[model samples]
Target: MDSRLALAAVVCAIVLCATPAALAQTVQVWTRGGRAYSLTCYTRFEVVPFYRPPNATSLVVAAASPATPPALQPTESGVSTIAAVLLVMSCIIVVVKSRSRAKFEMIIGKNSNRKENIEELLDNYGSLAPKRYKYSQLKDMTGSFSEKLGEGGYGTVYKGTLPDGNPVAVKFLHDLTSNGEEFVNEVISIRRTSHINVVTLVGFCLGASKRALIYEYMPNGSLDKFIYAENSKITLGWDKLYEIATGIARGLEYLHRGCNTRIIHFDIKPHNILLDHDFVPKIADFGLAKLCNPKESYLSMAGMRGTIGFIAPEVFSRRFGVVSTKSDVYSYGMMLLEMVGGRKNLKSSVENPSEMYFPDWIYRCLADLGSLHTFDMEYETEEIARKMAVIGLWCIQVSPNSRPTMSKVLDMFEKSADELEIPPKHCFYSAIQ
Candidate 1:
């Protein structure tokens, strides 16, 4: 009985500690035949002892229970998870913003360094350099960019008057990312040139975010307008055209030989040729010009630099030949043909598909007919046209070695049409092929 009573006490203590408050309250104890037993009684029971020993006692130890609370609610857990996610996202955003700001600041610093280098280059030239104007001064001169003269891929040209009342064409470059290389090229090349046919650079403007080149204004505008116009009021006769062609050749000759540093005008097209009031042709836009030693026959170019139609075969493909002054000669030849025909050298829409390439068509006409009688003209005009056509063909040979120098080109212009021989047909055939 003593041992049984001790076991009953131990079981009761365990039930009070281990069971929950609701179950502990329903614990029941009973004694039978001097033995004590404990049970966790609930609303339902499988069996009950009906026979009780004589003088047996029953004891029920009940504890008051409080309302049970859930271990963890769904809403509370969900809110905690969302807060943790938000905290992680915010940290990521801050890191990304900091990195972006650092990158932008680095780019600005590099651009600033480049601008300083350009300014130093200008300073080095001293009195020899073209006059420099402030960005504010340019705006005032251009009347807040009110009068736009023209716009191209690089920038816009505005007509402005200098303090001396001399009219100037201010070219405002829009692409700042180029780091002012084009501006530097134009200034370096044109400043060295002093000729009636080479357009003069009067001044320039450089700022933190702006760049411009000021040139002597040509009242007659570019050469393309006169050549390609349909019902144009400005009419240039064949003799005047021949004179213009000779003047351009002279300018090219000067650039190649007369200057201390040989300036190769890589881009020589109708659009780049400007005319004065008296209709005198001047070579303009030295942005693509390259300065080289007169002794160097070939130039090393990173990539093709001239317009598509005017780019020499060698400039685009190393398989043809090394790039040289002959490349400029090729461009001049294409432009000369355009001037003669009053149409582009390569045209998609033509009466005959075989005549699609103007140079080939002109070659065939010269070969078969011995004259450009397809277009009605006087004998003198026809003679001049035939001379220009033949000269153009000589300049645009597939192999650069075959093309004449600017000096030789000038000599060819001086000679009569009968003096010049026709270029090889195989040369023209290979060019078209």
Candidate 2:
């Protein structure tokens, strides 16, 4: 229990203990709404110390009345019945008053006196756990921003600590730059939304150009570090990889179709994808997120957004028109290809020019299911290759109109393996396999 709360409790005990004479004089009658009332009644006894366990307070409090008349003298049986009725009424009054006081204590329940809300302890939510710092107190929380974490186009991030001594990640934006708007948007988006797959925004910091966003520190760091690591054979195994893929897709689906406002993740890539303690994927960094009416097809930006390699071909085309949410679908498709290939989609490595070409190879793989077996044979490779090839190929289709909606892509995932149709080999690599 908090020392202050304990002290308050002690005060409550003293005040209650000190007012015994008044308490006895006017028995407080209470209603369910916590209001108190008083009623006058005949009482031969009063309740004693009720707060103490094993020996509850009960003291005899009697009321005086006129002496019984000789004409009203009762028989032995009648007197016994009268006594029984009076005793029962006294017990009821004592029980009600005791329950009322206990109830008052309950309404005043505090987190200092008890545990955090049950939902906070549970997952499937992204909460800013017990905010222990006010703006002035944040300097100690971030260790004066001494611990450098990472830097991005938007701003630099740092590591921080809580009064409870738990460590957290904080991203600090340079207040003098345009990055402040992006940081504010990210905080607003995350605070309003929560899902198992969404990155939990722990809190935020605002000071001039020194704005910062706090997140639940992920121990493993970003997904790009693992996938793009040099000579590392530590593959995110089939099950975990599948979960990561599905979780990211679900997060995107929620943004694209589940949210009250349609969100287009203009920048969806391995670098923006983070992993949690359980290895579940969390979609992060929405600096490039564009909000638009779902009823519309395009949201014009200053220019095309997102990483160069992942951007949709149509988006980069000189003849192609404005960018749309499907642009993200195209980038996600490329990301899926990278996951399937276990190599960069557009490898700048001079040794193999063909390595940069992914969708074409995937198209060739789909034309010949035999090639599917060679991809991550340790996995249910044939099935994965087939599904990835289908979904990926569909997402990267030249015309955005041809690509399946996120809901349809999810439906395609749910359908049995046998039910999925292998898309026709129509790309330039179609004749190879």
Candidate 3:
């Protein structure tokens, strides 16, 4: 009976109190983490002091009249509002800065230090080998083009022997003059921006509208031949393809962003990539390469010089104006897709018109789950398929800004499928003359 009476009194007191905290003479708080927090209730018509309490005013009811609230509110409220505004503004500022920086950076964390931008350094540094060489010297080294090694969009590549009898690959210009200078520029610039993954430039010779770049000989030859050739697919491993793709991405990123001035390898393709003894990718053929200023892109070409299917959509005279680093991104995307599909995308079967354009096939495959059922599961083709889809999707973003940089492409290849989304296939550009 006594307990009941006390409970009733407490309930009545709680209901009648004008200020919950004032109703109770004492207050306390407890927290789960051993930290303390408190909240107080006050009357609307109180004195309202201009001070703020750190953590005070817990609600309590004791049937007493309320105390007035303070004139000033909690600093947290003001601070929170101000902080929110500032945070949003800060975020906006960061995004704008990143976009602008990317124009200069041109890609992910790579430094923009192109050698051509500092050609003076190259000229001043000078070549360890002789700058000037007689045409006869080059002819003698190449064995008078008697040893034909390979051919590419740039020109014919021949085998040569240095003074030490070390084998070298000498790329001779087929057109001479204008063509040779571009090759020289590419060789010199690439040499200046050399890394271990890059094929080293030994030296050059200029004569009678004739120029040739000398490079270390690759026993295995270009990657395209090894990966796409008949009876060669099974010889490749998932790990090896991953390495090659990653290396290519890094090389492209270096050209696009790692230099002080951005370089666009506008002529990226399998033929342009030479392979070392271990099948490592060495980017070659810089004749069509474009040098972009910090935050600025190069002018478009007078006519298309890159391989037909690999050329960027923006490069066409009709679709857009002003080709940018994103041009390379588009090409990379296509290359990745090609690598994934094997030679099926490129192998022109006269009997089958459906196989003419492979990226279109990729889009069709992506649209239907049944299309991937034909994949050869006996090999590591699945892993190759997974990476190719991801890297290709990243490269082919319609907007240059939407695409991932070469650095990002390498990072993407390194990550697992669980961390990535199934990539979307790019739309085909209307065939441009």
lDDT per residue (tens digit) for residues 99-194 in model 2:
576677786675223333332322223443323234555677777878887765445667788667877777655423334344344455556667
Best-fitting candidate, measured by TM-score? 1
What are the clashing pairs of model 2? 45-61, 46-61, 47-58, 47-59, 48-57, 48-58, 48-59, 49-57, 50-57, 175-209
Q: Which regions in candidate 2 have their CA more than 4 angstroms from the true location?
A: 1-139, 174-186, 230-234, 287-302, 317-322, 350-352, 376-379, 416-418, 424-433
Candidate 3 segments whose C-alpha is farther than 4 A from its true place = 1-123, 127-131, 174-187, 287-301, 344-356, 378-380, 424-426, 430-433
Q: What TM-scores do the predictions have?
A: 0.67, 0.59, 0.62
Please identify which of the two predictions, 2 or 3, would achieve the higher TM-score against the true structure. 3
After TM-score superposition, the amount by which residue 172's alpha carbon in candidate 3 deviates from its true location, in angstroms, is 1.5
Ranking by lDDT: 1, 3, 2
Lowest summed lDDT window (length 10), candidate 2: 29-38
Q: By TM-score, how accurate is candidate 1?
A: 0.67
Clashes of 2: 10
Off by over 4 Å in 1: 1-126, 174-189, 231-234, 287-302, 427-433
Q: Native-vs-model 3 lDDT?
A: 0.61
Q: Give one digit per residue, the lDDT tens place, for model 1 in 166-284.
A: 99999876634444654665576678788889899888886767878899999999998988876322388888888889999998888888876777777788888899999899998
Evaluate model 1: give its lDDT: 0.74
Candidate 2 TM-score to native:
0.59
